[model samples]
Target: MMTFDPLGDGISRVEHLDHMGDDLRVVNAARISFDRESHLECDDTGQWLQDQDEKLIGFLAENEHVSPFFHPQICLRITMPSFLAHQWWRSTVGVSRSEVYRRYVVAEPQCYQPPHWRLRAQQPKAGSGTGELGAERQAALSVEVERLYRDIRTLYGQMIQEGVAPELAQAVLPQATYTRWIETGSLHYFVRACGLHTGPMAQRELRLYAEAVSEIVGGLFPVSWKALTRHTAA
Candidate 1:
């Protein structure tokens, strides 16, 4: 499983639940053109098979043959804040997911507490910035955020005690509320997701998630992962 503590809370993780296909699988899928198949365990050719597979992957990437790349599928169990999940779910093409349903289950609320508040960017469209705040101001903001979380949770629990439905009670929760989901998709889709979410100006939280998952993917399929990033970066 792949895991990351993007918020430094260690509460969030992206678990590599299960996956299918690999570098050789992509090569075999493409080799259908020549009515040939690559035997991954066939080391009788020494490094010849490995070298050929890497070259073939590069060729596939260069020529825009994405179908072969789609052969490798990855399934991830992602636990993240609701806001990041919303942005991730927006990259829907070639991706599929199912999320935890709060309508049926009632659980204690968990939240994302940022290490510190980021100041609003001078350019409003730039989002937040690392502008420093006084110790007093920072401490006050931290305390206020924690107080607000407690207040919201208390109200939510009171509603539940009063016989309110979970789905209705959960409406009071903020974007920082933690959520979980299982996402399964092709390698190409993940490459695309990484390309978007891990870019220079991507949301910081989502970028961390993307980078962690890409690390796992790269370790598992080095050659294909390299080919994918090279092609996408082009």
Candidate 2:
């Protein structure tokens, strides 16, 4: 399946829809600087292989000349909690997003229900801590969350029946509500995104999504992906 279960949350997924360009695109983009392009300019059969110029790619990467990486773009369809989507929305460069609108469609409501709930960070109002809630507490929380969503869905449908605008009705849903969107971005953007989200500050769920992205993008643009990420994350 194209769908990826990054956190193993059944409601969330990341699906690679399509992609454009390749390593040669990067090579040609770079060579364009000197009015040159890499194609079948040589009779050597190896020249027809990937990367075309490994040293040149490495040089560009080591020197941080990454504009060529922008030539390749990847598309993904992601389903995640609205809160996590808010975090991703911060990435506004070299990427575009088109999301499912609640006002237009009355899709079934779903929410993220982690098997083990995370504890709040030690510092006041920071991110989550390394530990998880005890199994007993986790079970209790699940029950409460299920009840809460059940009530929310009931209220939302009631409002819709009473002729309340769908937009206003959707406002009743919390950040935990699941949302879906289409994301398209350059190779460099995905690499940078994976690097950042896999870091300490990002949420655990978002980091998992980024790891899924790294796996796909890394496979798509192995050499250039490595150059940008340096294998430090994912």
Candidate 3:
């Protein structure tokens, strides 16, 4: 399987779908400034082919000349809870997405059960911390959660069995339902997204998702990924 289990319980996944271009492509795109094409003009030097190309990519990143990063594109298949998907969609600016539609396909009803219940953030606006409510309260919350999930699932199944349209039946699904989508964008966009989703302020679930994506992006473009991170730090 191409999928990586970023979040256990099979609730969240990040799969490398397809990609185009590469580190050299980003370098060549910027090399156009000199009215030169690396592919046509550069000689093939087996081991030293990209010696200076690395420096050029680093230079582009350092100076915030990010357009070259757009030369490389990547597509990912992601399966995440709807809550995380909502955050992901909000963070996306330069990416294209195609999500599975319930109108055509029945959504697999799955709800995320948190490892532990968390008390609301004290900050009043964001974040979550450990629950102050003792083990008994935590257990109580878990029990209620399971009951709610069962009820929702029962209703959804009943509707389907009654010949209700899948689209209408989907309305009863919970926010924890896993949704799948193909997200395609330039390497630059993915990097930018990583910067945000991996930050301290982002949602925890989405941050985990972003970290998984970064692993794939980094493996594909090591030098470029380094340059992007260095620039992002600055």
Each prediction's Cα lDDT score? 0.84, 0.83, 0.82
Task: Name model 2 segments beyond 4 Å from true.
Answer: 40-52, 124-126, 231-234
After best superposition, candidate 3 residue 204: deviation in angstroms? Answer: 1.8
Compose the digit string of candidate 1's lDDT tens values, residues 67-180.
998888898888999988888887787778998999987888899987776777787755767685778998998899999999999998899999999988999999999999
Minimum summed lDDT over a 10-residue window in model 2 is located at 40-49
lDDT of 3 by residue, 1-234 (tens): 356877777667899988998788888898889876654235565433357788888899999999999888999999888977887887565689999998778655888887676677877645775445678987999899889999999998888889999988998898888888999998888888888787766767777888899899988888899999879641
Greater-TM-score candidate between 1 and 3: 1
C-alpha lDDT of candidate 1 relative to the true structure = 0.84
Better of 1 and 2 by TM-score: 1
Error of 3 at 51 (Å): 3.6
Using TM-score, give the best candidate's number: 1
Q: Comparing 2 and 3 by lDDT, which wins? A: 2
**Per-residue accuracy of model 2 over 64-120 as CA lDDT, tens digit each:** 887898999999999989988888777787999999999887866787777678889
TM-score ranking, best first: 1, 2, 3
Considering summed lDDT, which 10 consecutive residues are worst modelled in model 3?
Answer: 40-49
RMSD, one per candidate, in order:
2.3, 2.9, 3.0
